[model samples]
Target chain A: MRKLGAITQRELLSLFCSPIAYIVIAGFWLVTGAITIWNADAFGPGKPATLRDIFMWTPFILTILVPAMSMRTLSEEYRSGTFETLMTAPVSDAQMVFGKYLASLIFYVIMLAGTLIYPLLMEVFGNPDWGEVLALYLGLVLLGIAFTAFSMFASSLTRDQAVAWILGAMPLMLLVLSVYSLVRRFEGWQREVVQQFNIMGRFGQFARGQVELDGVVFFLATAVLFLFLTVKVVESRRWR
Target chain B: MIEVRNLSKYFGKRCAVNGISFTVEPNTIVGFLGPNGAGKTTTIRILTGYMPPTSGTARVAGHDVVKESLAVRSVVGYLPEAVPLYPEMRVYEYLNFRGKLRGMDRPRREAAIARAVERCWLAEALTRPIGQLSRGYRQRVGLADALLHSPKVLILDEPTVGLDPTQVRETRALLRELAADHPILFSSHTLSEVEAICQRILIIHEGRIIASGTVDELKAQVGGQRRVIAELKGPQAEVTTAVQKLAGIVNVRATADGGWTRLDIAANNNAQNAVSELAAGRGWAVRELRQEVPSLEDFFVKAIVDARVRQAGAKEDRR
Candidate 1:
């Protein structure tokens, strides 16, 4: 456990010491803030007092942002040859993966926390639905968890960070955009099956203030599966 | 203590380490000497528990490297060839991180960091970021991190590769001091560096250990042949023939330069006195007569060449 904490702490220190973390966080805020202003009608007097636009656009923005955040987690270690020193330490492969994953998750949460000001601003101008807003935030956190794990798994596959980002972003874009598009093209049970795989569709339920157990399980399980794959990739070094 | 038996590693179809075996006992330093691509790094990696051997086994501190890797890793300190480090981290922060990774408590970590800093002479560079430091300082930082855990076994790959001469001398002194308590196995391609520090040398070539012994033992293995070079003011043919007739002379080659003839004589023993006697008998003026002692470099080259010749012979026999 101590080893795990050490890995996470080192990762966090590396993250904050570089300009990448701040650039990523600032980019997230700029995009979200721009979208919020473009959809100013949602916060006007006669409309519903909900953060629907912000919640709806976050998953798409995260498709790029989360991958950018995680692309260097393992890839940089490989490129710098620090992977040798790290693996030769007493920590297990699982602990290493979990430690790095935890650091990125913490950073994602911190970046998300900055958006709390939007809800505070909403409270001053008009009464917003607090329960719906909380559910949306919960849904975003779960989605971030899955996204972070998948991108970290991608990072484990290569030494080049740019390649890792593309490897992570391509599948994520397909999961969020393609499935949502395919949902409209299907009918009956076909549409239902596609909806089950659609990340945005699952997240839409939370946007409507419905906290489904299936959505929670899906996100958590996806995170675990990818994290497990990442561990396997790290272990593969011994054989290769 | 560390023991490896018939360890082998293959990357796809290419063999990186092939059936190599050696042991390092307590309170001794063994130099893993080899040219590039000679499997030194691969063998060190296996013993340090960074990777498992494809065949056979290695044990460190009585723990199996494959089955009890974590236990092995906990007791071993490794400095890789490149001295990989988190460039963004301060030297002290990096050492603290390594201590934590080794599961050291805060108080113990502090003491270990101080000891390592003092030993590696890293007091001045502790606050500087690793990337900002020079290559030599980065190497010292790596050495400091390796000593932080006070490991029972230390495996270093080319620890002095990038250091200046003074730093190299200091590192050699440091390794000797560390060897009083911990068994160390370090790899180097520089024969002189290994000759200066290591008590035992393992010479690896083409993925195999071609020769291994003490400096004198290896020199003896190449037959201890000495060469006597004589520059005499005499006829080239007479100088060559007379030197060839001398006792202990194996072969002699003469070359003419201006008004002098130089004879290079290979001998089983000292031929300096015999060559000088012949020069006096022939009324030739002796300019220079000296016997050259065989060095570790000669043994290393001979060992590699002999191995390659034997390999070629084996291939020929198969046909």
Candidate 2:
């Protein structure tokens, strides 16, 4: 537990001290704001505004940003040689993994926090459905957490940051790609599995205003599995 | 105290550390003297419990390294060859974080950080980012981090590799002070510095202990005899005749300079009395007569070269 706190503190300080967290949050705001303003016709017009515009764009946004934020989570340390020191320290591997995971999770949460102003503006003008708003935000956060886990896993796969970035980008691309009809090449239960496993399909119920435990479990399970794999890699390196 | 036996580490099929064995007593500063790619770093890593041995066993502070590793690691402070550090953190912050990781409490850990900063001369950079510091200061921060929990045993790998002369002297002073109460194992390729600081020398080559003993003891292994040079005012024939009459002189070689003869005498042989007697009996004025001393470098080269030859012989035998 104490080790977890140390890891968390180290990751948190690094995220804030560097421009990583601010750049992530600001990037979200600027991109979403520009799109919203331009589509709403900028200054004075029949701009049918909704809270969905801000969050409706995040899975697509985080498909890029989360990888950028998490590409260095374990990858940078491996490249910097701090990963070896981390394993040599008296802390357990589990504590180290949790520390890094939670740190990135918190940073992603801050990025999500930037979109709060979008909802605040929604409350002033239209009688936007608050439940759907809440559910959509929940889905974005869940997906982000799940995606961050894989990004971290990818980061752990290699010491080269560029290689880590490419590896981190693969899962999000595949997660989006496996849902397309090309997945039918499997031609059986695998096809049925792919159709249901679509991340966008998982978000459908939530965006339309319903709570889905299945998707939540999926994201949580993915995070645990990938982080566990990262820990195993560190352990094996020590043995070798 | 530390004990290692039949320790071998195989990375895939290639062995980084072949079977080896040794013991280190408490409060002794032992130097691992070896050249590059000689498995010095790999051996230190296993001793510190940072990595495990593939076969055989090791024990530190009465705990088995593979079985009771956490207990060993809790008391063993390590500074790897590369001096790993977090660049974004301040010197004090990195030390504090490392202290906590080694299980020190908040108050005590903070105090330990302060002491380490003072010991490593890092007070001025306590608040500055580690990346902003010079290479010397960065190495000091690495030392400070290693010293932070006050572990009973220290394992330092090439601690003074890239430091300028001044910083190296300061680091050596700090290490000398620490050696009073802590058992330290420092690895280095330079024999002279280790000879000055360490009480014992461990010469390794190709993942094996080539030789181990005090500097004098190791030097004595290869340096089995003493060489005496004498310059006398007499004919070369006369000088040679007088010296050969003395006992314990194994071989004599006369210089081309006409009046000088160099004598190789067996260990424990008294050559001065022989020369003085020769000078007294012959009435030849003696100018110079002394035994030449051998340095650690001479011993190190002899030991490592012998080990390499032996390893080659063993490999050929296997084939």
Candidate 3:
């Protein structure tokens, strides 16, 4: 456990010490803030007292932001040859993978936390639905966890950070964009099956203050699956 | 102590490390000498538990490298080639981080960091970011990191590769000091560096250990036929004939320099005394008579050449 903490701490230090983390956080905030304000009409006096727009647009922005943030997690290690020193340490592959994953997750959470001000402003100016706003934040957090895990898995697949970013972003973009279109094109059971895989659609339930067990389980399970695959990839490096 | 037996590693169809075996006993510094693609780094990686051997086994501090890799890694300190470090981290922070990864507690980590800093001459660079430091300082940081855990075995790959001469000398002295407690196995292509520091040398070639012995043992192995150079004031033909006829002289090449003849003799016995005796008997004035000593470089080249020759012969026989 201490070893795991050490690895996480080192990873966090590396992440924050460089300019990448700040740039990613800033970029996420700029895009999310601008879109939310545009949708909310610059949060004008007569606008609805809701942060739903911020929560809705976050996953879309995160598909790019999370990958940008997590791309260097493992790929940079490989390129710099620090992977040798890191893997040779007493930590297991699981510990190393989780350590890095946790660091990125923590950074993503910090970026998410920055948006709390929007809800606070809503609460101050008008009577916002506190429960719905909190639920949306929870959904966004879960979505961020899955996105970061998938990006880190992509990072594990290559030593090039740019390639890792593209590899991570492409699938997520396809999933986010294709599911909505597929939901419309299909009918009956076909639509139901596609809707089941619709990430944003499921997240809409959270926007309505519904924290269903299956939705929580789905996102958590996706995170775990990707993290496991990352561990396997890291272990396979020994064979190579 | 570290032990490897018939360990091999193959990357796809290419065997990076062939079936090779050697041990590093306590208090000894075994220099792993090889050319660029001679499998030294691969062998060190397997021994350090960074990778598992494709065949055979390696043990460090009595733990199997493949089965008990975490246990092996815990007791081994490895400095890889090129000394990869987190460029954004400060020197002290990096050491502390390594200590934490090694599972050392705060008090112990502090003490270890201080000891490593002092030993590696890193006091001045502790607060500086690693990227800002020079290559030599970065290497010292790496060495300090490897020492943070006070490991039972140290495996370093070209620890002094890019250091200046003074830094290299300091590193050698430090390694000598560390050898008092740890069994260090370091790899290098620089024969002179290995010759200066290592008590035992393992010369690898073409993914196999072609030779392994003490410096004197290797010299003796390749220096079986001695060389004697004699400068005598006599006719070249007469001097060559006289030296060739001597009891121990295997062959002699005579060259005329000014009015004197110089005989380069390859011999199996005391050609120096025999040549002097022959010169005195023939009334030839002897200006110089000396036997050349074989260096480690000579033994290294001879070992590689002999291995290649043996390999070629085996291939021919198979055909």
Candidate 4:
């Protein structure tokens, strides 16, 4: 546990020491804030403005931003040869993987914190459902966690951060790709399976203020599953 | 302190470390000598628990490398071939981070870091970012991190590859001092450096240990046929024939240089006495007669050539 904390702290220090973390976080807020303004202004006054624009657009924004944030988690270490020193240290494979994953998640939370202003604006200008607003934030957090896991797994696959960017974005791309024909082609429980498997589909429940256990389990399980694969991928490199 | 038995590592179809074995006793320094791609790094990786052996076992400080890897890692300090480090970290920060990973508490870690800094001569560079430091200072930082834990075994791969001559000398001296308390197994391609510091030398060829012994021991092993060069005032043909006819002489060649003839003789034993006696009997003026002994470089070359020949012979037998 102490080793994990140490690695996580070192990883966080490394991430923030460079400009990449700030660039990523600032880019996320600028994009999200701009989209919020455009969505609120472009709508007809005839339709009641809700916080829908901000909550609905977050997953898409995170799909691009999370990969950029997590690309250097493992890949940079491999390229710089520090991975050897890290692995040879007295830390377990799981500890190393978790430390890095947690650091990315912490950065994700900080970036996500910037979006709180949108929710505050929503409450100030009009009547909004507190439960619904809370659920939206939960959904965003869960989605970011799951995305962080996939990005970490992708970082484990290659030494080049650019390649990691492409690889890490693949899962989220496939998730978005499912909306077209991929979902329409399925039927019955298979259709339900695909729907729940879709990140946005599960998130839709939380957006509606219905925080079901099934939806929560889906997001948390996805995070755990990918984090587990990240550990396996790290261990397999030694054999290679 | 370290024992490897029949260790082998295969990468796809190529064998990187063939079944080879050696040991390092406590309070001793063993040098791993090999050409490029000779599996020195592979063997060290196995010993450090960075990579597992395909077939065999290595034990470090009484821990099986594969089974008790964490224990092995804790007890072994490894400096990889590339000197892996976090270039963005300050020297002291990196050391503290590594010490934390090794499970050292605050006071102990600070104490260890101080000792390592003083030992590695890194006091001035402690606050400097690693990326800004020169290659020599970066190497010292890597060494300091390795030595911070005071492990029982030190496995360094080409620790002095990029250092200047003076830095190399200082490192060699420090390693010799450290060996009084810790057993060290370092690999290097620099023959003279190995000869200068290591008490035991291991030469690996094609993933196998082809030669291992003390400097003089390897010299005597490969320097089987003693050689002697003599300058004499005698008939070239008669001098050559006379040297060949001398007891224990294996071969003889004579080179005439105007008023003097030089005889080169390969022999299994000292032929100096017999040659001088022959010169005295034949009334030839003997100007010089000196025995030639092979140096480490000569033995290293001869060992490599002999290994290749033996490999070729084995291949032919199989065919």
lDDT of 4 at A37: 70
What tens-digit string does per-residue lDDT give for candidate 4 at A39-116?
A: 766444545545666666667777788998999999998999899998899999999999999999999899888878
Higher-scoring candidate on lDDT, 2 or 4? 4
How does chain B score by TM in each prediction? Answer: 0.82, 0.88, 0.84, 0.84
lDDT of 4 by residue, B10-78 (tens): 999899999999989998999999999999999999999888999999999999999999999998989
| Model 2 C-alpha lDDT per residue in residues B90-192, reported as the tens digit of each score | 8878887888788777999888988888889988899999889888988888888888888788889999999999998888888889998788889999877
Ranking by TM-score: 3, 1, 2, 4
Residue B140 of model 1 has an lDDT of 91
Clashing pairs in 3: none
Provide the lowest-lDDT 10-residue window in model 3 chain B: B240-249
* Model 3 per-residue lDDT tens digits across residues A1-240: 888888888888989988889999899889877887678674678777877666775677788889999999999999999999998999889988998888898888899889888888788888788888888888988998899999999999999999999999999988987896678999998888888889888788897789888889989999999999999999998888
Worst 10 residues of 3 chain A by lDDT: A51-60
- Runs of candidate 1 with Cα error greater than 4 angstroms are B225-292
TM-scores for candidates 1 onward, in order: 0.90, 0.89, 0.91, 0.89
What C-alpha lDDT do the candidate models reach, one value each? 0.92, 0.79, 0.89, 0.89
Task: Encode model 1's per-residue lDDT on B1-319: one tens digit a residue.
Answer: 8888999999989999999888888999999998999999999999888888999989899999999999999999899999999999999999999999999999999999999999999999999999999999999999998889999999999999989999999999999999999999999999999999999999999889998889878886776678889899988887788788889889888899887998888898778898888889989998999988788999999999999999999999999
Model 1 achieves a DockQ score of 0.71
For A53-167, candidate 2 gives per-residue lDDT tens digits of 4445556667777887887778778778787677667888778877888989888888778777777776676556788888888888788878888888888778876678778
Choose the strongest candidate by DockQ.
4
The DockQ scores of all candidates, in the order shown, are: 0.71, 0.56, 0.72, 0.74
